[model samples]
Target: MNFNLLHEIVLGFMVVLLLVAVAVIIERFIYYSYIERSRKRLLGLLAKGDEQAVLKETKGSSCPHARLIGGMLALKGLEKDAFESKVQALYLTQQAGVKRLLWMVDTTITLSPLLGLLGTILGIIDTFNALASQGVSDPQAVSQGIGTALFATAAGIGIAVVCLVFHNYFSERVERINEQLKVMALDQAGAVAGEGSGVRGGREPARIQPQAAAA
Candidate 1:
């Protein structure tokens, strides 16, 4: 194999993977920021039965949580079973949205180390080839191959480590958002059902208390 081309290819791929991972990290952070900011207020509006208010808050928002809450609000007046069913469907849809682009990060995590290992192998091969041809008379060739091997190995490991941290963080964020959506749906459903029949699950439906958005 042409070690030079192979080295470049490995390095180029690693760079691309790192860039993609970083982009995902930034995008998810921004999205989570929006979701966290609007959560309390939107739930409060739902609790108050202020459809107009909730609509206004969710206006133009792309957050799955926002859209999920808005969808739930529109499904008001449904019977308990029907309401729960619809909410569940909406929940699954929104959950899918929340998971968007996450697979790329996962790909980065899995591919980086393998690419690095390939580079390392290529580098060692080049070193042996250089020494065999030149009998150690050409120090530069041997050093060049070793350098390629080390750089490729390091870059691959570094990218994987960074992406792994973010992957876990984003995964946890998804879980938390999922939990929040479940609570909001349950509360909104209970409140609506309670209004119709004055009870839910053998008791008054839980209400979402209003709170100020985090600073």
Candidate 2:
């Protein structure tokens, strides 16, 4: 087996995986920044039923939290059940978006070491086969084969470690963001519900006053 080409392909794949992980990291950083910036202010607007301001502010955002605010704002006068249903639908969409590209990280983490192990085995096999054919003519040949096997083993483990750390970091970050958005949606919905209750309670006194006057 031609181990040089095999090693080259494996290294090239690891390079691509590294680039993809970097992209995911940067994307999450931007997304998290946008979400954090808008959260408090947008929720405040939802509480006040200031739909216009919320819409205007959140118009250009791609963050998932902004969409939750939008969901809450859209249901400004809604009953609690209706509010929850809409918010839940939007929440799932945000969860899906947050999880994008994570599969690639997992795949890279899984494949890197397997490929390295394969390369290691092949390197050792080729070395021994050469010794059988050429009678172990050069001491350097033994050293070169051992070096190849060790390098392949190291490369695989290294890729697995790097990808695993990054995957965990990004996945945990997404989970936190998802939970925060869920809380924000429910809080805003509860506020609207409370406001609705207050309005109904205040009208009851007037309703009774008019009936008493008629009687």
Candidate 3:
């Protein structure tokens, strides 16, 4: 019934938590709205061996995964070692981008419980202080302190739960995409190498003819 105590318990932490939550929601929306579609298009282009099309599709986009695929395509004629190196570099870059903002989600999950514990400690301290001043015989005053203390713990756990769920789901999606990328890279590499070998084998070295003596 006492909102003042609830406000005191939630206070600044609630605002911070709300902001973090909003950020996560926005990130998720962007991922699904734009990044997800781009990924599907990238995969399709890779499957069709349309490197130019893939590059064009991702040229203006900031998606890391798309950039990785494009980078590999750019090295199409390079030797195996060079191509692999380029691909690996691009893969690492894309991985980092995919994992961006994940740390914040992790931090929220880690901090939520601690914040709740802090609230609980403060509530207990307040309750004991009240008891000392007003006497232990007053149950109503004691209840107020205990109730306020529990609010922090509840909020912390709730925030952590939400963050954990999102983190796990996003992580799984990323893993699946990474797997697909790996497979596509291997297949493309083999196809390109085979073509290069066939061309080299069919070609003959140039022969030089002696020049006729000048008068």
Candidate 4:
């Protein structure tokens, strides 16, 4: 097979991955932002400390933070172990959700440059082959190889950088959300404990009234 052909194939594959990475990055960014907003809203509601209002506001919410709060509210005199278990479960669920499509993004970041390098090597080989067969008589033939090689390298570098930036941004955002969740869980756990010792007395947690539950 011709080195030129192989090089083009590798470049083609790199282009495909770049396209997929762009799509995934945009999707993940939007989804994560949505989750963050929902979490923030839940936290804002949680801060009010009105048991009925929290449940009412969070009713039908799908945010992991809201779910965690819900679990906390549900437990009246239950052991801390049960609440801890819920916390762990919520963390795992949030982690899994945040990581959706991250592997593809990471793979593109790692593979793009390697593919570009492979293409560059093949381009060099093609240039040499052209020079030998055509006796350096055709400068255009050699130049074409060099151009293709450089093009692939530039494209790969560009793709990799974008992916890396996106991955880092997402990682930071996930960490922030998780931290907020942990803090809220601890605070609410304490509140639940304190209230458990109050007049509520191990009864069912306060529920949102349907009339006020409309979001």
Candidate 2, 66-185: lDDT as tens digits = 776665566667665665566666667787777777888788788878878877777777677777888868979788887977787788789789878978988788777867765655
Residue 98 in model 2: shift from native, Å?
Answer: 1.6
**Candidate 3's residue-wise lDDT over 6-83, tens digit each?**
446554675597578659867866874577788777767655656567668768677655665556556668776666
Clashing pairs in 4: none
3 or 4, which is superior by TM-score? 4
Better of 2 and 3 by TM-score: 2
- Put the candidates in TM-score order, highest first: 1, 4, 2, 3
Error of 2 at 166 (Å): 1.9
* Displacement of the residue 183 alpha carbon in candidate 3, Å: 1.9
Cα error, residue 14 of model 2, in Å, equals 2.6
Q: Where does model 4 exceed 4 Å of error?
A: 50-61, 74-77, 193-215
Query: Each model's TM-score, in the order given?
Result: 0.84, 0.78, 0.77, 0.79
Full-model lDDT for every candidate = 0.74, 0.67, 0.64, 0.71
**122 Cα displacement, candidate 4 (Å):** 1.7
Candidate 3: stretches off by over 4 Å: 1-11, 46-51, 191-215
- Per-residue lDDT tens digits of candidate 1, residues 1-215? 67867878888988988988899889989988878888866656655656667777767777776787677667778777777677777777787777789999999989998999898888788778767777988778678769868888888888889899999999999888877776665555665543642212232444332221100
> In order, how many clashes per candidate?
0, 0, 0, 0
lDDT of 4: 0.71
Q: How large is the C-alpha RMSD of every model relative to the true structure?
A: 5.9, 9.9, 12.3, 7.8
What is the descending lDDT order?
Answer: 1, 4, 2, 3
